[model samples]
Target: MGEKVLSVIPARKGSKGIPRKNVREFGDRPLVGHAIETCRESELIDTVAVTTDSQEIAQIGRRFDADVVIDRPKQLAADEVPLAPVIEHAFAEVDGEFDYVLCHQPTVPLIRPVSVDSGIRAGIQQTADSVVFVVDSTHHYWKQTDDGFEAVSSDRENRQLMEPIYGEIGVFLSHRDLVTRGKRIGGSIEFHTVDHWEGIDIDTYADWQTAESHRSRKQLVYRVTGNDQNGTGHIYRGITLADHLFEHDIVFAVEPNDNIAIDMLEGSNYDYQVFDDNASFVNFIEETSPFVVVNDILDTTADYVTALRAAGSRVVNFEDLGDGTEHADAVINALYEHSNPPENHYYGFKYFCLRGEFRYATQKSEISSVDRIMISFGGIDENNLTARTLQALAELDDQLYVDVVLGLGYADPEQLDPIVEALPDNLQVEINQQVQSMAQRMEQADLLITSNGRTLYEAGSLNLPVLSIAQNAREQKHPYAFVSRGVLSLGQAAYVSEEMIRTAVTDYITDETRRETMRTALADHDIANGIERIKQIVFDETHENR
Candidate 1:
C-alpha cells in the first residue's frame, strides 16, 4: 500500500436529472474535468485517472488531462449495481498498487476542491475504512410515514434548539485495504464538515443554483471569516447541503470550537471531525488539485468568502449577488450579487427561509380531545416570550388544551409555572421540549399561536392557519409587512394580558371566515418551494455555461 491515491470519477450513461450531465462543462472544462483537475491540482495523489463504463466519458476525461483512462466492464458498469463494486472493479482493471482511493460523482458540479482533497486526507488521517464528505443537520429527522415525512427527535421544538449533522454531499476516500477486504466502509466511518462552497451536493436540476453563485465554494472562505455563531445561519444551512453525502471528517476549521452551535453534529452515526479553516484550508484545496474554489455561501452569510481567491487556492467566486458578481473559473451563483445590499435588506419572502416538510408535523392526531389549544413557541427563542404567549392563551376561553411547545434552550420551568397552575383541566400543559414531530402537532391543532419566523412559514406551508406574534424585534419586523401584504401578524400578544389573548384566540377560532382569510393568504405566499429556485440557479447556470 503506497501513498498512491487514485482519483476515481464514475461516469455512467443513466442520469435521471441531466442528460450526459457528467461530461458537460463544469467550469473552464467539462463536468468530469473538475474531478480530473482536482487530482492534478492537489499534487497529493499519485495519478489522476477516470474510470468509465463509457468511451464518451473517457474521451472527455483525457481531453481534460486524465493521466490514464480505464474501460470498465459491462457488469461493473451496469446500473443498479452498487458504486463500491464498480470502484473495486475499476481499481482491479486499472491494476495498480495504490494506497488511497478517491471516488467522486460528475453531478457534484459545485463541490469545492478543498473538500475533495480534504476528504482524501481525512480518510488517510483516520486510517479507517473510509472517509466521506458530509454536512450537519440541526433539526430532528425521521423515516417517512403514511401522512408524509416525520421528525423523530427533539430538535424542532424550535429551530435554535436543534444541533446535528445531516450528510448532504457524497465525496469519499478510502484505503485500498479497506476496499479490498470485502468492506465498503459498512462500519467505522469518518467525515469532514466543509463550508457551503465545498458542499452543495446536487441531485435534481434545482439542486444547482445561480441565486447563490456569489458564495459558491471558492468565495466562501472570505464570507465566513469573523462570523462564528449560527447567528449568520451558515452552520444550519450547511447541514441540509451536506446530508446527502456518505461520511467524512466534518468541519474545515483552522481553529475548531465544540460550541453549542455545532453540538448537534456529534449525534449522527458517522465519524466526523474538524479541519482548521486557516492556511491549511487552502492546503487541502491544493491536495484535491482543483484550479478554483466555488464560493457557495457568498450571498447568504459572511462577506469575506473571497479571501481564499488570492493565490494557491485560485478561487472562483460564484455570487448570487443581484448584479452578476466578479469573475472566476465559473459563475455558479445563478443570481448576481450587486455591490450594495437592497433597499429592504430582507429581499422578498423568497430569501426568508427554507424548511423541509418535517418542520411542522407535531404527530398529535392521537389526542381525542379538541378542547386543548397546543402552544409551541419555537426551538430557539432568543427572546423568552413563551411566558407572554402562554399568558395570552391562559386568559382566553379557558376551555382549550394548551400544549405549550418550548425548547430546552429556552424558558425556565420557574417562568412557566404560574401560567401552568392557572389553566383549567381543559388546558393541560404537555411539555414537548423533546417531541420530534411539530407538523403532527400543527395538524392536530385547532389553531396555531406562534411566532412569524419559520414557525409561521411552516404553519402556512402545512395550511395550519396561525395567530402570528412577533416575539422579538427581528421576529416582529417580519410579520407586519407580511400581514400588510395580506398575511396575519398579531401585535404585542406576548406583552398582552391573558384577557386579550383569550379574545384573539376566541375570535380566530370561532370565526371560520377570518381563519379562512388568513389561510388563503398563507397558501398564496408559500415559498416552501424555494428549493427549486436554488436548484435552478446553480445547475442551470453550470449547464448553461456549457
Candidate 2:
C-alpha cells in the first residue's frame, strides 16, 4: 500500500496585481483548475482539496471534481496574511488524517504532476520534515550600504561561474504534524529543483504573458550530419535556424559517426543526442514525438520520412533532391532551384539563411585598385582547394595583399604553409584559421574567391563580388551562383589549370567595370532576411495540420 498524501491548494479572491486572477481562464482551463487536475493525475496524491474564500473558486473546484473544497476564514484571506494559517485551516477541515500534506500554488499552472509526485517521494524516502521546490536564480544581488549600493558577494565572476542561489517556487510538501502546528517549513528540509519555465509564478500582467508563452512552447528536433566529406554547412545551417527559435525547445539528433557535427553542436546553447543507426534514430523520434523534425542531412529516404510522419512529427528537409522530398511536410532547397517545384517545396536564394554576424556587417565599397583579396572555402575543404587557390594567387607579380581563411576541417595545412613561405615579396599573404566572424573578414577585402556553396550567399549579402570554383560534382550542380550573374564561375577546379586561375584573377583585378556590374547585380537580390522567411514556413507548416 502507498502512503496517504493530501494535496491542498489555497486560492483567495483578493489579488492586487491582477484582480480575481485565481478563477481567470488560463489556457483551456481556469488557473486553479490546472492545479486540481495536476493533483488528481498524480499517482502518489490520494486526496486533492481547494481552500478558497470565494464561492466561484469553490464551484470551479467542484467542476474539476476536486475531492474536497474547504471554506477559508475571512481573516486568513487578507492581503497581508501568509499561507501557513490557510493550509492549517484546510488540513483541520479534511475528513481523514494523512501522512503528508502538499501545498500547491494555483498561480503556477505550468507545474507537471510528476513534479508533485517527485516532491512527495523526496519527503518520504529521505524522511525529511519538509520538501520545498526551488530553481536556480541567475540575478545578481546587491544591498544598500553607507558607501552606496554594493554587491552582496565579493565574487565578481561570470554568471555561469558564480555560485548558484536558489529561489522558492511557492510549492512545498510538509509533514502533517508541521501543517497542524501552522508551520509550513521546518527542520530536515529537502530541496526539489525544477526547470526555470516550471517555476514561473503569475502575479503581474507581464508574468501572465510569460506563463502563456512558456505554455505554448513546443519541442523541436533537428536531424543533421556533417563530416570532412560532406562539409559542415548543414550543421552551421541547423545551428543558425536553432538560434532564431529561442522560444521553442530545440534538440539536435545526429548519427554516432557525425563527430564534426557533434563538436559544433557542443559549442551551442541547445541540447543534442547521438543515435547509433537509422533504426535507433527513428525510435528516438517516436519516443520524443517532437512538433517538427528538421533534416539537414543532404538527402533523406522515403522510408525515413515516412517513419517520422508516422511518429506524429512534421518533417522538414533542406537541400533534399531524393524521394523523401515528396513525403516531407516542407522541403527547402535554397541552393538548388527547380523549374517545376511542388507546392510544399521552397526553392531559390530567397530562403537562404545567413549567419547572425552578417546582419550587422558593413557592405563592400568599390575600390579603384584590387590591393586586397580574400580566399575562403566551406567549413571543411575536403579537396584541399585552399592550397590550390593560394598557389594560383602566388603567381601574381603585382604588389597584391591576399587573406586566406582556412576551415576547421582543412587537412593540408603543412602543404599550404610551405607555399605561403615561398611566396614572392610582392605577394603578401596572411593565413587565418577558424575565424570568429566571416562577415568582418569579407568587409576588409575588395574581392572574394570561394567554393560554389553557401559562402557565395554570404558574400552576396555584403555586396562583395565573388569568383567561385566548383569543389565537387555535387557543388557543380548548384546553378544559382552561375545564373544569378553576381558570381563569376570558373567551372570545376579539377579541369581549371593554375594558369587559368591566374588569368581570371588578373582580369578581375584590372576590370573595374566588371566588378562594379557584379556588385550592382547582387544589390538587386535580398538574401539577409531568409531566416525570417524560413522561420515563418516552419511554424506555419507545423501548426497548420494541428
Index of the highest-lDDT prediction: 2
Q: Candidate 1 local accuracy as lDDT?
A: 0.56
The local lDDT score (0 to 100) that residue 223 gets in candidate 1 is: 19
lDDT per residue for candidate 2 within 50-80, as digits (tens), equals: 9999999999999999999998989999998
In model 1, which regions exceed 4 Å deviation? Answer: 1-236, 244-258, 269-303, 306-346, 351-354, 359-372, 379-383, 479-487, 492-499, 538-546
Give the alpha-carbon lDDT of every model.
0.56, 0.87
RMSD of 2: 3.2
Model 1, range 1-546, lDDT digits (tens) per residue? 236787777887666676776766555667677767766777567777687877888888888888788887788766578878877866676656788777777656666676677777766777767877777656656878999987777445665756665675656777787667644565667877776545666566566553135234321222121132223233333443344222212332323653433454445332333456545655555455433343444442222334343454444333345222442333332121223443312233443334444443442222232365666666556555677666666545446666777754564657678777886565667766766666667677767676655565556655556666666654555533354323355565446455665677777667667666665665676456444443333222322111
**Number of the predicted model whose TM-score against the real structure is largest:** 2
